[model samples]
Target chain A: MLFEQVNNKVVRAHVTAQSPVLARRGAMLGYSGAVAFRPVRGQGGGVGGFVGAAMSGESNPMMASEGDGAVLYGYKGLYVTVIDLDGSYPLTCEADRLLAHDANLQTSVQFVGSGGVRAAVRGAMTGQGLFTTLVHGRGPVALLSHGGAFPLQVTGQWPVGVDPQAYVGHTGNLSLDLKAKVGFRDLTGRGSGEAFTLQVTGQGTVYVQASEQKF
Target chain B: MAGPSVFTAQSLPDGDNVNPYVYSIGLAGEWFISKGAMLAYYGNIRFEAVSRYASVRDFVAAQFASPVYVQDWVVAEGQGKLVIGDRGFDLNAYDLDDGNLTIKASNLLAFDTRLALKQSIVPGFVVLIGTGRFIASSNGPVIFVEPPFRADPEALLGWADCPSPAVHHDAAWMAASFAGALQGALGRTSGEEKQYDFTGTGTVLMQSSEIARADPAVLRLIEDQTRLLTDAQAGSLGQQLMARVQQR
Candidate 1:
């Protein structure tokens, strides 16, 4: 793995000439050795990723860092988690959640509502926009979240329900559907604060943070 | 390197903390959860607003006695592992075995249905009584201190098994400077001059940081208490409040 967790809230990525690092702009806490950071526009998914970011309102301005040293990365005091990708399952996440990742990984835009209009509505309710960033052929992807984030294993038999505000990312084959638990009583009274929940079906892992605070 | 723990539907702990900022409540029957506190849940569970649930469930009205907090709490029922968190604050669950704990309303996250919640006489606080578990959040790690001490109002998280703290003023500081005296006379002292004085035997819970969230119920509680004041006094109080706002 190129990214090693220095602490719960920080990650140290060993940067090399061959394996450069794409990191969030202004997230470099510090670095050692000779590392050069250049602001790169639309660095994640190329042309398609740029257009998707504009359309999806999920813009993540990244910087390219390359040198022969270790670079420390952190953002907004958020906790960091590194997911190792074996080129099997693509990691789906919001662009802003991406802290740092191997520049060798392939990036593309994926529709949050891969199932059409109904899924689009779910995506809107999640406040994550219509398109999400998909990292393919990743060596290691670093993500940030409030408090910290943990993965919940999802199986074919048991589905997991998550609050959209707490969702960080997911890996493997999974279908996300929005379930509204609202009823007549909810319409009448103050209503349940948690009226909508994101249901993850199929098989994979869902990453969620301890907080429901919208970023 | 090892990352955060991975939890499954069956592996989530029962009424235990997943981390310092997250708590997992294994639910079979019911729990009184603060509104917007839940992060996620596994299995079958339903969250009903206390206002709506009070009409259907007889016990809701009996357990939740603070009307001001009705809008901020919900009842989660059924079988599931409910996860809750508060704005990245340090969270801890305390067990109250037939005891009472008065806590800052905004800091008290969730409580058991077996415990009864009552509005504390202290404006912005609530008391939980009976044998059950409840979760609370603090800006930092909670520090346990004893009685015969004075605490800054913002730093005081809560006091358990003790009479409500009395307002304490630093008389020496008040008399130290003319400007300070003037501010105190105008009821606009630097906020460091006033404190909560605790006496008797009890544990006082304090957060390492003084930052705290404003309780939404405080306005209503203060509004409700206004009925005791005469109209002239109320008018003067309004003027004072407006002056304070203007100064800010």
Candidate 2:
């Protein structure tokens, strides 16, 4: 996929895909022209070997030694970008597993900062991976997801509280408390059943939820 | 019962005066005698004042000054005059709201129970006195008194709801109005000048030229008004208003 900013709007140029890809709503990703395309070895193996091979000369098939096009590849296919400014960019998943599973990717994003300049924080979730990017912050934060994403809000009123196990990522600092759901007579099941619930208090927002099934 | 035998006798200390002593009393009633004179009676039995005559009024007054003794009296509905000792006071069921009774005492034999008086009731010290052990049914072993023994009016008021202004832009209004008035009079004739006076109508007036030139006075009034308005807006309703503003 490839994209460019035109008239304060993001315009898609071209999307090259061997298979059908779902178009996300907010932003499009694609490559530029003048970039070479090639097959890289050792990408389908264990994590260590794949990392080693990617940095070696053997993976230099898709190279942009002289031009502006940045080369990006998936595990199974190669995407070549040509100077087709009118073509639409294809939406592709950076995760190999998601590309294979063809999972639906949904995202909730926000932009913060001042002036014409802004910082973008986009959180995306597939069935197998949770991808979040601080596209313009000091550093990017990426979290692995066991499930898809659900958006949540916590404020002074209607504070969004959740069980600890269900917590994913929170935007600001929050408070915690222990809440009980049982009585003393039921001591055997006390703190054993759905016993204690973690309460989050304070002014901020939190996102919580899990996948529909085991990842 | 043989024709009630009336025995004219002086009060005795620590002695049980019953039946053969010619006391005619029914169920659930108390008759206390002290200093050998009739003191109090709830039934046919006359209570003689043994040592000194201490009326309920005297006991209440003394208790208010310094906590003394509290007692509970439990009288069964159908039983004859049975003097039960130290079994704790039985609270009156019809008088309780939450159904719990508590009593305070200086000694095991003496205790005091305070009652909350109605606002309509006379605003003065009033109390209910009990002797020995006060007992009740399932309701309470507690007593109710007026002019509660230990309470600070100021502290109690601090916890109570207080009045506050309702406007959100009140602080801004005060600041703007005072500044406007002060600046309007900065170079005016001294005799025509005065301090900036803020009317309840949200208007500002210069009382004296001397005060108008007083930068400290103008700043002080602005500061005071701003603080008052901020405090008012932080109250419960103000919080609700702020929430509404955010939602919008």
Q: Which candidate number maximizes DockQ?
A: 1
Residue-wise C-alpha lDDT for candidate 2, range A15-122, written one tens digit per residue:
234212222111111223432221112122466644543443122111111223421111111111111111122221222212111111122122121112111111
Quality of candidate 1's docking, in CAPRI categories? Answer: incorrect
User: How well does model 2 score by local distance difference test?
Assistant: 0.26
| DockQ, all models | 0.01, 0.00
- What are the runs in model 2 whose C-alpha is more than 4 Å off? A1-143, A178-192, A211-215, B1-248
lDDT of 2 by residue, B1-248 (tens): 67966443332212233422222223333322111212223324433221122353354333323211111211122223323222121222122332222221111121213322111111111122322322222111111212111111110100011121121222332443356457542321211111111112211100000101112223333444555565566576567878999999
Q: Which ten residues in a row have the lowest lDDT in candidate 1 chain B?
A: B180-189
User: What tier of docking accuracy does candidate 2 attain?
Assistant: incorrect
TM-score of model number 2: 0.19
Model 2: lDDT of residue A135: 15
Predicted candidate 1 versus true structure: per-residue lDDT over B119-224, tens digit per residue: 9888888999999999999765666667765665665679999889888765544454345345442332344446677888998876533344677888888898
Global lDDT of each model? 0.81, 0.26
lDDT of 1 by residue, A7-39 (tens): 676677899999999988656654556666655
